[model samples]
Target: MTRVLVIEDDPIIGEMLTLYLTEEQFIVQRVESAREGKFALGTFNPDILLLDLMLPDASGTELCSQFRQLTAIPIIVISMKTAVADRIQAISAGADDFLVKPFSMQELKVRMKAVLRRVTTPKPVAVQHTQADSASMPESQLGLSLDLERRTIVLDGDHIETTFSEYEIMKLFFQHPGRVFSREELINAVRGIDSFINDRAIDVHVTNLRRKLEKNPKEPQFIKTVWGVGYKFIK
Candidate 1:
């Protein structure tokens, strides 16, 4: 069974999530505060985390950062804040997705499944060298190699962690280096064209990717902005 840890302060919302998730055959453990949530992380060892932004003890973003350092498990933040900034903040803090309050249970489930699918499914790594030949390639020759099975990026002999969206975006960039991709094209490729994700969200994902891959994010070397157009990978 898939284990889920929900950190929600509101009793009603917590109960509703537990009930619905349980009906879906998920093993859920809901907590009402950040402290409890932290404890559950060790005990429950959940496959995914459903976090509420307004926790009683600490903000969800803080916990999100902390949890991300401890585990690579996917996190989906649930909040009443609908501002684009809020969504960006959560994603920057390591959330895989964000859902506003008063959201339909069906929509939440779909988002959960989508996020989980990205994390669990192992896709082909898009790079010039195959995994077997990667070890034989010179360090300078190896640009960015994806390990979809582990959901990680091997860059310059370093293993870097990436969120689901970041991994998807990087995979697309590796497949078509030197091709400028507009924000709309990137959003469509990563999150589906029908997704309501803000265009700025793509910027946030790219920024995060740069932080992980580039030596200096201020002046990125691998992924460059085309100003007015979008971005392209030069690797």
Candidate 2:
């Protein structure tokens, strides 16, 4: 069974999550605060974490940074912080995904699975492509005006910081522009995450990524959606 650690302070919410994850056959470990959350890391060896942004003592952002130092376990922020900046900040602070509160229990489970897919997927060493091939290869770095080698996003020729996974996903899309890719295909190619379109996990990541790279997210010309299909990176 997969192990999950839920770092939530609210007893009621924590219990609800525990019950649901339990039914899903995940070994659930519930912690009330950042302190206990740290302790459970050693004992439970959680594959994924459902972290609350607000704690009784310390901030979830702080905890996320600290937890990252100890392990690379996927951290999904379950918070009431619904602002765009807040969500971006949480992701910057090391959250794999930010889930707003008042979300359904069913939604939480699907998100958890998506996070787990990315977290548990095996990382195989990749061969470096040839320089000549690289010359022909158009990377997302160029589409986003980012420097793939330097790992920097350039907006109007200015650098914009992005998470590792975000960069990887962008690179994949940039390499194959105009190709329609299912969420599962995108996840596997980029971060090895599972497709959970019903829960809109891919949409959230794409939105976050667009806001970082696009000058006007409302009118995104690069990333387009296929109603019954999936997402694709277009010109």
Which model scores highest in TM-score? 1
Candidate 2, residues 1-235, lDDT tens digits: the string is: 8888999999988999999889989899999988898899888878788889789978846767777556656677888877877766666566676778888887777766766654432121223444575466656434445465555555434455554456556767877889998877765664334321222445667787788766688887778877777888875
RMSD of each: 4.9, 9.3
Itemize residue pairs with steric clashes in candidate 1: none
The global Cα lDDT (0 to 1) of model 1 is 0.80
> What global local distance difference test value does model 2 have?
0.69
Cα lDDT computed for each candidate against the true fold: 0.80, 0.69
Q: Score every model by TM-score.
A: 0.81, 0.56
Q: How far out, in Å, is residue 7 in model 2?
A: 0.5
Query: What tens-digit string does per-residue lDDT give for candidate 1 at 127-209?
Result: 34356676886877467677767777888545676666788888888899999999999877766654456677789889988
